[model samples]
Target: MAAKGQEFFEEQRDQSLVKAHIVSKYFDAWSNVMLGVRKQYGRIDKLAYIDLFCGPGRYTDGSKSTPIMVLEHAIKNPELASLLVTMFNDKDEANISSLREAVGALGGVGSLKHAPQIHCSEVDRDAEEMFAKTNLCPTFSFVDPFGYKGLSSRFIHAMVKDWGCDCVFFFNYGRINAGITNSYVERHMDALFGRERAEKMRGFVRTMNPRQREIYILEELAGALKDLGARFVLPFRFKRGDGHRTSHALIFVTKDFRGYAIMKDIMARESSTEDEGVPSFAYSPAEADTPLLFSLSQPLSALKGDLLKSYAGRTLTMLQIYEDHNVDKPYIAKNYKAALNELEEQGQIVANKPAAKRPMKNGQRTFSDATLVKFPALEK
Candidate 1:
């Protein structure tokens, strides 16, 4: 599975794919912390970087793995090397070897003063132990699991229950939903959604067939992150068709609001500057002129749909959408359309329309209906 993403990474290194967004997002967050360290901390308090499913460098077109690039950049700060540590882990032995070689090629051991540890092990096992052993230090972990799914509620709980830990997990909604909305999750749901979510999700999509799995998985995931007490989360997706696609949740969960602020800051910094005639958030509208969607092996339309409705529940206008989320607008629009269509298809909305104010310049509000809203307010 890890190899597959690597392959995809190599294939889409220069194109608009998941790898680009993934790397950019990480660097944004890492650099933000670096700024904080310089301005406030004045000295990083043992700054630490952890990649749960960190793969090796050079995916397809020599594009760098996020963790490795982040490590390289972080240590470049004079204070970072002396105070920070990098722990990059993967379950694949080959990937681990590649990571080691990558670090070595760049000059290992002596190259980095923080003594970054690159290990080969399941992140769940290693993350827990590492957390228990380390003292309070700013941490950033990338839980990029395979397309099916990755990590668990316990994983989020253990790392985040403490206020200092901040994690960004890749929720492969399409792949997981194909199974989750079905009977595949019957056994280990508790592991995935934290009991409460598992049970609620099971009930929500019980009558749904395999096709509805994506929605169920996405809802369950957002619910799980909420369970872990996340302030806010925005998804990242890669679409293949109008309704069929692959999507993942780049969920940010943290106990502190600063973390939420930090995520928002990072997303805005990393999204496309190009005008794709759509909003720039990961889920921006088509007119936003932004495109960052990528592909994986997951079928996540339903999950993406659920998340879009989640957005409609709170957001009102393009400005509000931009303020509340940091993902590109095209991505937001994708999620928005999925959820809106789902809501409408289910007869949840009878007269849903955009709430328009008087346009002094142009009274084209008659056809100005690209804004999102849910009639009858489905799924409060």
Candidate 2:
């Protein structure tokens, strides 16, 4: 293990806390969704959570890590404790040992039907190949490597191949942003983005500015995952503590749109700021009032315009419009609701509510998924 790895656990930094919160919270919600499906449909019998580079259970500052939080969540939910299986692995023996001790110290470890499995193995080609060949339970894998050595599209594709399987991996943007141009790290970069795309990106990014480079790189990565049958890739950015630049991001990948939508809402809640009701989708220490040189803002006015133009003369439920438009979109359902409500109020569109009043939220009328919206046709 490198000194950087050691320094990471010395104290849980602010970014680390955000990262942990995003992962654990997603896992909790994911479990509940899966559990509900199992109870209603009985299509799934087990759900698995695998952490490829799980670290020691606690930071030197005594803050619990994701593994411990995961266990705690499962232990508290009797339904989840019975069906959720966990596997945690780290190349470092010391981390595995510390994790074992930490897991043992948890309050309800004994309640779990299946004990958490711990493994000490390097996450290299062998691990990737093993996962690709084996059939995994509906699994959620978290891959957090020290750098980008063991993380690859092949491994990620394998992790999300099975039904209900999804993955969240750490994208080391700082290292990658530098590595794209450096000849030394070319092999790892190729493995991540595929050989041809990586070579193409290296040349493509040369003429681009910093912001353009970031967007292009992420789009390329998302494209690669989509090509390999893993659709619905979402990234959550983490800025350096100084807020000068982005350090890394957590990329969520899955084949299902429901998983994608669930994660999007979760990420939106954790975002640092919103512009005109649209989330920034980043974590930065800079004050919310600070002016930015570049910002990606999707105002409600723009959304309303888009909806009117795109769905002119068509009658569709709010859910249908959101489902069709939300892919690769920064706007969440709330933004959609706000825009739709404004359009209805202004007589730009007709919103038909259910005959029976739907449940009121915050004691105010709002558009439910079933609300029928009709947009006026474009001017002839």
Candidate 3:
């Protein structure tokens, strides 16, 4: 039998499909944004997409994976055709061979300015060292290791240190949860969370229930990334097919809040449920049993209270509030607008458009990015 995770290459699964779509979609949007920048500034000439554990280009079920999806999208866009640089790596020689064949057979591969770079090398500490020394262009790197062996904070940091660089890695949370206290995987855990933090995490999670443990670990990982200068970090959880437990997650790391905002919107759209317009940022299969509905109101209510308290006595435009408050939060721009609108209706806050501007939607005055909002201070 094939090793774990290799089976998915044989036949794509639902979670894999979701993950691939999210990555490809983000790349499409991100590249377009970069293209716009290039046109305006004439400085950004090349964009790169690196996939460290890219599988065979096509699954046994005849479905294209992320590498092909990204290339296909780029091929269609003339600007991306000249500006994009693609790279794919897999340690398995067989997989590499298969990907080479599939890519060679692509309809428009010949039109790309830079041919895709394919490599078969084990990604580990040496690879991390190489990345640290290399100068990367504005790049989006995807690191999707089978378990946790080839993934490290240092490696991810190196990939995103340059300007306009961002990373998304497959976080095998289930393996990590079990491996935390396992002596055999201790070194790997140390590499991922750093030695000091990993040691503390092991003891801290001893008493935490599974839900609490999951939250704590993810927060710690995000903290670690932040400590390494990744200003924004977000996670999209993927639950097991049974919808009972988390199998893994895709964590995005970036220095730019704009990238963070773009990814936030993408993940929000992919989320299985949006409770009160607030996305759960997770994907799980629908369960057979009827689910509870009362808790949905809590998110908007909490957001309203949080915004009122956080911005008390301050007046700022809707865009300003979103840019200032959206880092590391799951509430997208719409959720913020909804919360602010409700606050205005309840007389808890004041939202107004500029005198010189009138923004309307469907013949109704609308709260736009330029709309000014003022929150009254809390009572003493």
State every prediction's TM-score relative to the real structure.
Answer: 0.63, 0.91, 0.92
lDDT of 2: 0.86
Give every collision pair in model 3: none
- Which pairs of residues clash in candidate 2, taking residues 3 or more apart in a chain or in different chains? none
Over 1-380, each residue of candidate 2 has an lDDT whose tens digit, in order, gives 54866545432276677789889988988888888889899988789999989999897778899999999999999989998899999999989999999998999899999999999998899989999999998888899998899988988999999888999999998899889988998999999999999999989899998778888888999999998998799999877645566778899999998988988988888887777778877877563436353245547778889999999999999999999998988889988988887787678998787423656566445888988998899999
Who is ahead in TM-score, 1 or 3?
3
Ten contiguous residues minimizing lDDT sum, candidate 1: 360-369
Q: Model 3: residues >4 Å from true position, as ranges? A: 1-12, 287-297, 354-365
TM-score of 3: 0.92
lDDT of 3 at 22: 88
lDDT of 1 at 94: 90
Model 3 lDDT on a 0 to 1 scale: 0.87
